[model samples]
Target: MSTLAPPLRTSWHLKLAVLSASLLFLIILATAFAQPAMRQNVQPYLLDLARTNPDNTVSVIVQKNSKDDASLEKEVNRLGGVVTKDLHIINAFAAELPAGQAVNLSTYPGIKWVSYDAPVQKSLLGGLICTDCVSTTLLSNDYDYSINANKVWNNANNSGAWLQGQNVGVAVVDSGVTNNLDLYSKNALLRSRLVAQVKVNTRASNAYDNFGHGTLVSGIIAGNGTLSLGGYIGVAPQANIIGVKVADDQGLASESDVVSGLQWVNDNRDKYNIKVVNLSMNSTQAQSYLVDPLDAACEILWFNKVTVVVSAGNNGADGKPAVFAPANDPFVITVGATNTYDTATPTDDTIAPFSAFGKDETGGVKPDIVAPGINLISTKPGLAVKLALDHPDHLLEANINYMRVAGTSFAAPQVTAAAALLLQSEPNLTPDQVKYRLKATALAKKAKGSWDTRASLKAYDPATMGAGYLDIYAAVTQKKITDSANQGVPVSKLLWSGDSPVNWSSVNWSSVNWSSVNWSSVNWSSVNWSSVNWSSVNWSGDYWGD
Candidate 1:
């Protein structure tokens, strides 16, 4: 101790002060790092765009806090935004905004996030409010009776009330919607229930179905009995149809064009009362839902309270097909196809061999439900629309205006129509709520039969049948369901940057690791698929076209 006396006697107070200073430095450093993490609102793509060619303009979808649409548009204008499409449903805007401005937009007041217009990247840390929250069914023949749409319209409880989806609009975002007699408005106040029509991806003059797919999709959702005299009444016949043409005369469209079409739909949804969007198309790309632009688009739509319905693709029972884009997205309802075998019961029904199944790249199961796809007939243009021209034999001898088509494309609109009916029945239901109700009420196909026979149940495989087959009657009339469909679920955009899929258990759902992301990995290039880029390689080119 005597020898150590020379070694400057360090006091306990000095040690305490050193420790305190170290902690204070750490706290300040952490605060500096934490601030940006708190607002990881700029999409990686927008960041890249800002870094490279900052002056270049690209269409981006922006999510902001500002409630005023006019003011928001003005802000966008101030930032050199052009062709700005108000996607108010998601509290966003689709504009050709300058790259630098789009990236820096996150710092602006009310600006939450900004991403390339493929779909989007929305902040995970906010409460949702449906921007324009406004919110049934019957059918005939194989799907009509099979899906129980007929019973829904003429049900004993709903009897004369006729829940035919009054005022609800189903936007058919496809080739275009040809005006058929069945699609005409029966009301005196309105000229047509085909509420809005606009050309999306094409230079076509009008948004009428020269390609035929949109009309068929629309008819499946809301065709009346003008031609068949109630014999071929559609599901939710009284529902409004908002036709958006994203394809050319040859039934081809670019993904950008399709996105623009959706932009149009979102902009005008309030005007047309469009709540349900029927995307009867599939993406050819196998990109993870985490990065797929289409997935981004559908996600924003779902958040904005629009019920998005997509086809599961026609890749067939392959080696676990990566369920195509919007369909692979967990938020929207993805539909698969089932062959009714010309019967009205599920005992004889089998999953269509050509219908795509999935365990998406993100490990999410796909095709939320199945519906009649094989030999399903709906409104087709009498003139040589692409589908009709491609398969002349499918034209019904009884009615040339109706054509039988098969694929998940036809199956998606059925669910869209059901959603319309559900909205009509319960106007205040959110998209997540709608998803929950549809899934909760959907009857699980029994091991030996449908829900009609309360027998031994089958182990559900979400890849094949999703929750179960579409049962519109049960979905509409079921007890009130309040749970959110996405509760404790993984969102597509929050994926980890590495090759490995995100471990949802360990992730902080409220924050994003923006630094690790490389948005250049996202493929926005458009290549000719011999048809529309929205159609899958095997889907529209071969199987779906059949």
Candidate 2:
């Protein structure tokens, strides 16, 4: 037996080589098989968009054909995504899918979530730069407050023709307004004005100004008084103010409270006929509707015809972009801050040092546009208190006069005022159309490094300030019409099977008559509530909360 074995001796090197080759082949096969499945259900296409627009997000819209949408959801989760909303086959899921996924469409299936994002700007102003910059008019006893009595009447008050039937209203949803002499002194609320000071907290009951932020914001939008030192008049001083306080005396408010306040606005928009709503708040992250109260409220407002404005957070300069919420929404009008006085050809409207930059996890351009947010002057509620302490000479008893401050918060109201004026000039415009008009009418500033004094007058680019500086005059006078017809899947008409009532909120239903396809009225009683498209429903009249 030993001799026979010796005669047929085999080489160990050949056997070892074969074994290694087989192992390598197995690895190759495993890798090839796993890659496709990993990408099969993930939304690979949205990664690029997310990367390009840091401040913006992509909404993955997926169509579910199977039972419970569970299979589709499971696939999305495996690919490391959270489901933001659930839509019946008729309604579409609009999810703020996070960044960092592969960009190839071949990686995922049933992934339809892909939407461009918009920012949310706020109202009011603040910063240390305002300390020495208080208006000097009050310091001099010679200050004649009566000198500019008629100055408050600008484009917003153009009598007759262009301003006749085109009346508009703005809901200053913030800290309650004070009856300041500066505003009331000049009759800022033109007879048609309606004010509702809703409490930020039910316990507090009164939305009184503990911190003067809201008051200042309101002044910037419609204050009629002269600046104590040096400041400009608000963009629109004629629009009505509806105060829904979300911040408290401590200068803070909760997302839930803000949502409730917005709900109040939605319930009463008809009474005020509020056309523009300003929200100058921020949240670091955009939670899914399952967990976020503010996002849900905003969805309601955005679906309605209200033009909502929000801030693009102040978290910045740490290499990573600051987190700006609500403004991250696709439907809302997001505004960023820019330094004032840098009006060169290559507009030096670079991201403010404190202003947050946009980037997907992988880095992207964020912030739709920039406004003059730095060192602005607006109204302050505690102005009476501060004025009594800082400048007793300027105080007028019982007259909630005006003061100044600075921040993106204040900058937002300037835009809001501008928007209010535009709305007043053109009442037929829908929220979306108004947004398009604003973007289209904005004047292009010089690029960061471009040589042209006016690089271009075209619509915005994602890389630079999205649509450039907002020009209210241009938005109001532009001959082109902005179309606001929502192309999204309409959920308002869909019927839903849920514990919550499927009908539109009584407030939404009562405010306006929806466009009907047939001669029959589409009131709640006439329509087959059961057959209605719940997917298109907008419970909030026209403003996103928080």
Candidate 3:
């Protein structure tokens, strides 16, 4: 309901070093704090935030070690910091303090970690991240055969009406959603399937698809295509939606905006029967899920029984080492883009050239699943919307308006629809079960396909593709089983949740291994922490914060 403000104590000192002037970065590396028993609790990025802000006002989410959130609030209040939110779900609270005092706050005896509220935006190509730069690679508009959405849609109940994801709600945390005909409710009393519309970004005029990307993402998940006359239906036509706007009209957003949006989802999940959350965007940086504040926010929702789906970034062809957060976080189902080539068969599907590939911060092959992202068509608000205006070539309108856009940003919604469909059928599958089923039943990308042609026992690459392409039919029909995907994974909160010995401070902090997130992969020389310059990265509603 309010901005993040918390108490701060400027008692501790943590030095910020620019390891490589050639590369923009601010990392503690824990070399200075590696004394007798001091644990590096404050994230280095927060220090950078304090140093670069013109106003010197920094916001953060502080995680506590043992005591309740109230005690932590009192401590923050004593330090003259503003206590913004009491994040009970993750044993943490959001607060705003003086920029340079984050390390002092981290020194609190009970505090576990302090994370910077960084900026998050759309998951477009790394350098080419602009509304106008993203090319409209429209191949064809066929969802039924491409991802087998038709099979799931065809299965009807005894009542004669098929289970087109009826009533199961998905929270679209993006720019905004338009109340177009495709999203209108089947019931006469309801205005649209969007059961709720909340705006985290108060700067925005209203919660509508002025940016246009949110409308497209919303349509991909549950658009009925009432305007297209069955020509372009979404994965779950009958599924309801909840629009949570985190970005402004121009599609720019901060990580705090997203965290607030996720908080809204957590608070209202049961009220709207919200089962899935579609995050087709990511943060502007790539930090380990263990310390990344955004990961904690998304994990809170996943723990509260909301299945979170995220898109891998568009850094595939660029040779980047990892995907951005919360996609880099393993708890949620992270999806990548695949060029379906307008074909039903899986033999020809290849990970989109621009679709993000390679390992995440944890060194695990990212994109738990893949879906058609290139040249995909979905509902558009209008030609005046930001995305449509930025790339008019993407607007392929008939009697009803639709836009063709490409990137992992668009790919993730297909899986969100699949998650909704599965939840609609069973209504009891946990987030872990949903993730396990999707990865287990996915169509493994084969080498017999026309491209790589390399012979091997396993057709898919364990380093990049993870499981494989999306098969909604197989995923939804899988045996309803319960299992945990993050059994040995780091909890992300406790001091040194994942101790790599090789990474971090070299002063082993925790017992958990954090799976195998090779922190060494992060290039210290290339990270840019200076005031996140967005003059070039015009993320058109793909707010995937790192």
- The residue-level lDDT of candidate 1 at 213 comes to 77
lDDT (C-alpha) at residue 34 in model 2: 48
Question: What would the per-residue lDDT of candidate 3 be over residues 442-524, giving only the tens digit for each residue?
Answer: 77745323332422323355556678767777777666445546654554552223243224344243332333333322232
Task: Return the top candidate by TM-score.
Answer: 1
Tens-digit lDDT track for model 2 on 1-546? 000001112467577666665465345334423453342222222444544642233455553323244555654453345577765522234345334322222234443223222222221244212221112121111101111112223223222123211245677666566645434423233443336677856544466655555676777676544433222345554456777776555445555566667777777777878877887777654332222345445546655567788766665545465444455555567676655431211133344455555632223344555566554445556644432345443333223344334356665676676667677767777777777776665557433222223345343345435566665555666646565522342232212222232344433433333322111111223333222122211111111111
What's the CA error at residue 260 for candidate 2, in Å? 0.4
Clashing pairs in 1: 65-110, 119-297, 136-420, 136-421
Write down the RMSD of all candidates, one decimal each: 28.4, 25.1, 27.0
Instruction: Report the Cα lDDT for candidate 1.
Output: 0.66
lDDT of 1 by residue, 1-546 (tens): 000001122587687666665465345334422454334345444566666766677777666555463555666665556655766544566778767656555455565455566422222236333211111111234577667776666435322435678899888888888777788764442467887778966466677788787888888888775665343567787788988888876677767667778778767777888889999887776666766666655665665568898888887656556676777787788888887665445544677887888776546567788888887778776656777777887776545667777888888888899999989988888888898888776657453223344322243455588777777887776644566676555555533333533455665643433233332222333322233235521234124444
Give the candidate order by descending TM-score: 1, 3, 2
Model 2 residue runs over 4 Å out of place are 1-167, 185-194, 226-231, 286-291, 342-350, 359-366, 383-402, 445-461, 485-546
Error of 1 at 444 (Å): 1.7
- List the lowest-lDDT window of 10 residues for candidate 1: 130-139
Off-target runs (Cα >4 Å) in candidate 1 are: 1-140, 155-159, 186-190, 317-319, 445-462, 490-546
